[model samples]
Target: MAGCTGATSERTAAAVHGLPEDALLDMGDFAGAVLKYLRRHPVDRLTIAGGFAKLSKLAAGHLDLHSGRSQVDPRHLAALAREAGAGEDLAGAVAAAGTGLEALRLCAAGGVALGDRVAEAARATALGVLRGAPVTVDVLCVDRAGVVVGRAAPAGPPERGTAGGAARQD
Candidate 1:
């Protein structure tokens, strides 16, 4: 089983190692804004997705001093990913608990955006977590005038914007 062990090590190395800082997932069809965002800022979603997986075990091993719990939970990782703006990969990685890193990587190939919908979807998929669900988290994209842009809130009813045709924040 030495070969098996070697293979496992190799896979782990890949996950922890080199991946484009600008690389984004290619999940079928991507939206225009996401594409635009990536084109404008070609970075690997802030590297939190990668850091979370790599540092989890190390963090867990020193639980007492760190006042830590049993291990790093998906939500914890999700928070890190969000702060890092790593997007869905953060959700998947934390949710998988080290198992679905590969799938997360694949999904992240399309790229990660700190958008309202993506964060909401990731939270729901990862752990049935939702925005403002005990964990106070809101994804707000605002312009120079401090005006909110992008998503307003899916479930909430639509409201009129200050200017006609302008996007509203719910």
Candidate 2:
């Protein structure tokens, strides 16, 4: 279900950027919201920034991050962990973790960049969702403390801090 936190973040971002409150949107559907907004607005660069759990879902190719529509699949994450060169034990732990954040923590402790992999996967997924919409999409996973735990920068004109690269700072 939608909550006040997302609305509050959107409003805060809009206010801080001096844009209209509606400029930054969160209707609980990430891909739907972007697609709907794109229908009326001309956007070149899009940044998908939010919690790690939903970002993990995005990495797993879920267009909708709502609890009703999708969930963070630990098995998919375990596969990503394996792709990141994590051992089977770690992958098993990730699959057993209660949340995406826990899986990330396990990867971090094991010197694996699971978040980076997840971010890149999420970026690719977002690009696929856009389907040649001429938008450069970046996926960033930030924790509650305002730390950029992971990021996937798309190839595009450099603006703000977006450069083509995978970021992992656990």
Candidate 3:
């Protein structure tokens, strides 16, 4: 997992519990390293989760999951609000939020299912990254309080469609 700091210790604990190889990806060449690792040792499944703010970028197919290297585009958040049927005022609020969590709060206040959209986006990004591999992906979105806000799983075979992907964050 990238950006494995603070609230993301669950991933580290889970990784430690498992009896297998673990590596800290180099931020400079994250995608290359991930692809190489996958090629060297194929896996049956992959699960990724992270903070809500950080996960937004990872959900966008960004291999470099470092917060410093990536960001949640407010435009995307606004689009999500609009897709969820949020009024223009709510969308504007989401777009103007100073932080992802703030945007999420705005969505909650406006009764928009932003978490689901974020989860789906994450799944799509993960699928895009592992486009050709026959791997099952699970994406989970969690909040700062360590609560699951959203989740997604591959529907079926690894077809080249936008249905399945993996990774999540809080």
Candidate 4:
């Protein structure tokens, strides 16, 4: 014979289901209400500035671009750079990537050591532009907070600082 279910258990399950259903229910305009609440509550906001170059540290070890004859992996490059203290320029470059996640990926791929390597790579490309190598590369510079301070393509002229410093003649 089949066992009969108890009404108490059925009621309990129904009650449990009703409580969590709120998550599934759509709360139209709830975000506006929350924003209003926060506005009234007065929470402090912090501004963080960083570039794609630094954030790329997260994935720097995975990149294998421009490797030939036992090329250093991105992670190895990053680790080495970390040991050698090569974060700043790379971070600046990553910050210059125009987006947060892209910067992070570059950081991860270039690794710490790879930061200098990438910067070197960028410098080499810049130098090639100087030498009329005919290869096109874009150079971007950012401050420590990841804010883009400069961008230059191999074919374009250098940018001027906010105070109108003399433009780089090269």
Candidate 5:
């Protein structure tokens, strides 16, 4: 799993059953590491779950999940807040947030289920990334508290405007 926070390691292990071992990788090496592992192990199914913002980038086919390499676009957060029916002040606050956690907190304060929305977005992006791959792909969104806020399986039909498209709050 690609993630920006320390909690991703524990959360991913809990979510993916039968994971024999885990390896930590930097954002620059994440894609290469995954490819190497797949070549060696050849798993039938793969599940990727992590922090919402980092997972979003990974799902979008970007290997760099580092905060510096890939950032949560403030405009996207603002848009999501607006779609969640946030007031202008809340939207502005989200837009100004410097980190994903801050943005999430702002959303919570604004009465928006940001976690769920992030999970959906990450799932869509993961689907897009794994399109046509032999292995099944499942994506989960986990919050800082190690709570599962969103999940998606490969069996479902892809939703339009998802898959690295515009940010959708629904």
Candidate 6:
């Protein structure tokens, strides 16, 4: 697992899961970091742990996963909320939410698993990178307090999005 403790990290999850992390999961390039770790150590499965901001970039298929390189577009998040069964009002709230975590909370309060959707999207992106490498990927969306708010196991969704038109570069 990888993700925080510092401002750009949620290393609590990494510590809990016992991942050897040496860089910030946010700006170090999340997918790149995972692949780099794989090149050395061997692991059967992979877990990506982070909050909404980090995961949102992954969900949007941003390999860089940095604020400057890729940003969390509330409109895309709102669309995901709608796809997750959030009503118009709640979706609008997500669009205007102050922070990514706040938007996630709004979706959760409205009984929508926005983070799950995001995790699944991120997993799909990772699988694309893996390219049938026989490794399964799981993504966890953790809140700042180190609570697991959402998850997407490899066996969960068949595929959330592809490395195609579904992913938004912006």
Tens digits of per-residue lDDT, candidate 4, 22-62, equal 22212121212222333344222211111323312212321
lDDT of 2 at 108: 95
Lowest summed-lDDT stretch of 10 residues in model 2? 161-170
Write one digit per residue (lDDT tens) for candidate 1, span 1-170: 00001223223223443543233232111122232343354332211111222223222221111213234345554554455456565565645654324323433453543233233332222112111122211122222233222221322111211111111111
- Put down candidate 3 lDDT per residue, 1-170, tens digits, no spaces: 33132334344424533523253322232433454365456566555555666666665656666657777888788887788788999999998999999998899887887877776776666555555576555555677766766556543235634365443322
Which candidate gets the maximum lDDT versus the true structure?
6
The alpha-carbon lDDT assigned to residue 91 of candidate 1 equals 60
Give the TM-score (vs. native) of candidate 5: 0.63
Off by over 4 Å in 4: 1-73, 76-117, 129-138, 142-146, 149-170
Model 3 spans > 4 angstroms off = 1-36, 155-157, 160-170
Candidate 6 on 48-156: residue-level lDDT in tens?
Answer: 7666677787777776676777788788789888988999999999999878888998988889999898877777766555554445567777776767777876532
Candidate 3 or 4, higher TM-score? Answer: 3
Give the candidate number with the greatest TM-score. 2
Per-residue lDDT value at 112 in model 2: 92
TM-score of 2: 0.74
Task: Please write out the lDDT profile of model 2 over residues 74-127, one tens digit for every residue.
Answer: 999999999999999999999999988899999999999888888788776655
Candidate 5 accuracy as lDDT = 0.55
Error of 1 at 163 (Å): 44
Candidate 2, RMSD to the unseen true structure: 6.6
**Using lDDT as the measure, what is the rank order of every candidate, best first?**
6, 2, 3, 5, 4, 1
Candidate 1 residue spans exceeding 4 A from truth: 1-54, 59-72, 87-107, 110-170
